[model samples]
Target: MRDRIEKRMAEIAVIGLGYIGLPTAIMFANAGFNVTGYEIRKDVVERINSGKAHIVEPDIDDLLRKVIESGKLRATSNPADIREKDVYIICVQTPLREDRTPNLTYLESAVETVAKAMKPGALIVIESTIPPLTTVRMAEFIEELTGLKPGRDFYMVHAPERVMPGRIFRELVYNSRILGGITPESAEIAERLYRSFVKGQVFRTKSTVSEVVKLMENTFRDVNIALANEFAYLAHQYGINVFEAIELANSHPRVKIHVPGIGVGGHCLPKDPHLLVWPARDDFGLIRLAREINDGMPLLAKDLLFEALRTINLPPEKAVVAVLGLAYKGDSDDTRNSPASAFVEAIVDDVAEVRTYDPFVEGTHGSLEEALRGADAVVIATDHTVFRSLDWETLGKLMRNRVLIDGRHVVEMPPEGFVFKGVGRGEY
Candidate 1:
């Protein structure tokens, strides 16, 4: 198996070709592997096969086009297209339920599909972030379905992907990977396969430890961000800019502070902390409280908007709000578990009208000027690079009222003649 992987002779099947899966398939294909991408979404499959990507990410279009045109990669919705592959990499999402429980249905379904289609000696890899012990449980489930004993007749490994959305392709090549195998041989084979394209460091360990490490990485950030958000709340009370305070505190060299924002967003930070504590027998109060603090940040942004509205003597029902960006992060269109969506949902019923404009996201206003044309207030959600250099003084002429709310701290200075309120900017 190692020799086949090193020579790029192993046929690879990547299941769930969404954000992670498609890029992964492209990387392997670009690395000289014959890769077939299996996605349940027919539209995504058609798009990929046509050398286009469904999601927006840097360098995805050109790289996907390169692999697709080279005939090294193809995407299919049909299960038969992926049958009896030497390698199966599952990159499905393991989201959280409404009550903050880990939802493993997608992971289980992908594993079941791989079990039904895999050969005896095939190597199976799961790149999804999941609860601890899930890979072990999944190996047993596959054994029950396929009657093939794990580590003997087959090999299984939990290889979690650790890349951000905007820099996915670059990070895929540079980010260090952790391969947690159910057995020692499983980790070794998966490491060799990834080393075909990965230039970063690779480490092997037990499946459960890797799972805990992935979750802990996100949980640590979530907790630190929650601390920063708490400082923002304190800044509101003290009337001092938390950003400046954080900057001054960091001068001490031991006081590194995470930037406080409207909310934590994207797929990982909000959900992984919940998944980390979901299966534990003991209560994890700090982890759960961090999630709660981060989740409530949107409401804090809403409060700032309302305070600005009150200062302008505009009623909430009569105000027209324009939300600048909808995606979870800057320069990417992936909105899974986005705090911008949460903020919009929180104020949708109260506001008279809400206009959204994101350059990368569809189903919003055609242009930023169109969204702000008669709107009373403009709220900057995602801090896209374009927002940093916006000519706010010129654009303010299009508004009914020049009320600016900076949720993501895009505006460093308050433009003249506008009522500006920003998260962590204590002067309201």
Candidate 2:
């Protein structure tokens, strides 16, 4: 199997061509494999097959077109297209339910599809972030479905994606990967497959540890961001700039402080911490508290906007607020679990009118001018780069009143005649 894979003779099927899966499929195809992307969405398949990218990742469209033109990559919604592949890579989403429990429906469905379609000796690798022991349970589930023993009749591994949204393509190749297999042999096989495109180190381990590692990486960030948010609240009460204090504090080589924002958003940070505490028998107090603090940040931002509005004697029901940036983070078009959404939800009913604008997102205002037109207040929710260089004089004229609430602290200072309020900077 290794020899065939190394020789570029292995047929690779990447299931669920999402943010992680599409890039993974493209990279593998670029590395000389015949890659077929298996997607449940027929439109997505059609888009890719026609040389269009469904998701916005930097430089992915050109790469997708190149790979497709080379005949090394194709996308299909049909299950039969992937049945003959030597490797099946599942890149489906593992989102959390409303109660904050891990929702493995997508992962389970992908596993079932692989089990039904896989031939003997085929390898399956899960790139979705899942709860600990899920890979092992999935291996067992596959065995039950196919009547074939793992590590013998077939192989399974957990190699979760560690890339950020905007930099997924670069990170997929450069970031160190964790290849956790149900068995050592399975890990080795999985590592060999990744080595074709991965330029970074691939650490081999047990499936459960790999699962824990992915969870830990995001949980650590969530906790630190929660700490920063706590500090931001304290700074607001004390009338100090949290960003300035954080800068001075981080001058110490050992102390690292993450910047506080409207809240922790995106698919990973908000939900991955919940995965850690969900299955634990005891109360994981810190983890739960961190989640609460981060989750409450959107409301905190809402309060800041209200305070700004109160200063001008404008009630929310009479104010028109424009929310800038809907994506979770900057320079990308991913809106899953976005803090901007939370901010919108918190104030939609209270505000007289609300308009959203994102440079990369659709259904919002095409231009900042349009979003800010006739607005009484503005909230910087996502802090995209385009927001940083706004012409304040022009924007002030476009608004009914100049009330700027910087939720992410992206703006350094407000221009003359504009009332400025930020998350941590009080009366500055």
Candidate 3:
């Protein structure tokens, strides 16, 4: 088993080169292991092969270049090319259905693809963030397809990924990992491999528990954000700055609270909590309460802007609102579930025009200059680092009007004059 694992590590095949897969592949290569990134997108395959990253994760391009230069990393779209490896990790998308059901078609296809090429015994670890029963269900399908039993004919394990898009590499190596397998021995076997790269604890459990762990972690975040957002909404009614009150509460030394943004947005926090909504709907009704509060926050943010505009004596139809930041959060270009998008869509029904600017975004309103040009009010939906460092002097030259709506509370110096407002902070 040790010899077999050594050969597998010497040449590992990473299936589905996505945001999760690419970082995993790069890390394996960074550790001096040979890694083949198998992506379905021909363009993405070519890009990685040439040491260029499609996604904007910190230092990934540099790592990709280093690994490719060392001849330890490569990418290919052809299944025939992917057939020569031992370990295959499925990292394709697992988006939700219209009714918030977990869609596993991508996982199913990748399992079939690997099962066809995979030989007698190769370790297959699933690293997708899926709900309970996903790993077991996929394992059963793979057994039927390959005529192999888990931990006997081959090893099957589920190690759900706990990576933030911007901090993928650092977190993947340093954060605690939860490993689960069909059998006890299978869990041990998988834990040994992961322990090599991860500096943090390697926890072992059943496949179902491992799946649930990811959901629990992300859903907890969503719940906390919702709590903050709910308070922000209530505070608005009383003309109180929620952030100022939160700071006072934090002075108690027992409370550490998350800051309120326009809304909770991200691939994980916005959607993963709902992955279990269908299964636990009957017993766990409070989950629905959390989801409702969070999902409704974007609309609330829009309404707040409209109300603020009205206080200044401007109708929604006559206002020209500009948004700052489209990425889900600060410092990253990944916008899988950005709340700002929803905020724009919500009030656009009545507004004259809505412009947005994110330095991380490649196109659209493209630059900060466009965001401030001919604007009745500017709304800071996300708390990107660049927005915090904006020069008021430069913006003052480009501005058509003032009225800054700064959410996320990251801006230290509120956009000078022009009426600054945030979700939690009443006004400045």
Better of 1 and 2 by lDDT: 1
Per-residue lDDT over 1-428 for candidate 2, one digit per residue giving the tens place of the 0 to 100 score: 99999898999999999999999999999999999999999999999998889999889999999999999999999999888689999999989998889999999999999999999999999999998889999999999999989889888899989999888888998999999999999999999999998999999999999999999999999999999999999998999999999999999999999999899899899999988777678888899999999999999899989988999999889999999999999888989999999999999999999999998999999899988989999999987898898888988999999899999888998677877888878646
Which ranges in model 1 have alpha carbons more than 4 Å from their true place? none
| Model 1: lDDT of residue 245 | 93
Cα RMSD of all models vs. native, in order, equals: 1.0, 0.9, 1.9
Ranking by lDDT: 1, 2, 3
Q: Write the per-residue lDDT of candidate 1 for residues 1-428, one digit (tens) a residue.
A: 78888889999999999889999999999999999999999999999999999988888999999999999999998899999999999999898888778889999999999998999999999999999999999999999998999999999999999998888899999999999999999999999999998999999999999999999999999999999999999999999999989989999968899999989998899999988888899999999899999999999999999999999999999999999889888887877888889999999999999999999898989999999998999999999999889998889999999999999888988999899999998964
The per-residue C-alpha lDDT of model 1 at residue 179 equals 96
Return whichever of 1 and 3 wins on TM-score. Answer: 1
TM-scores for all predictions:
0.98, 0.99, 0.94
Evaluated against the true structure, the overall lDDT of model 1 is: 0.93
> What Cα-based lDDT does every candidate model obtain?
0.93, 0.92, 0.80
RMSD (CA, angstroms), candidate 3? 1.9
lDDT of 3 by residue, 1-428 (tens): 54555444546788888889999998888776778888889999988888899999889889899999998888998888778466777788888877777788888898888888787667788998787787888778888997888678777788989977788889999999998887787788777666657898899999889888888988888888788888887787788888887889889878877777778777778778877554553656667688888878777667668767877888878888888888888887877778888787887888989988888877758677877887888888888877777786678667665676776776656655666667766543
Q: Which candidate is the best by lDDT?
A: 1
TM-score, model 1 to reference = 0.98
Query: In model 2, which regions exceed 4 Å deviation?
Result: none
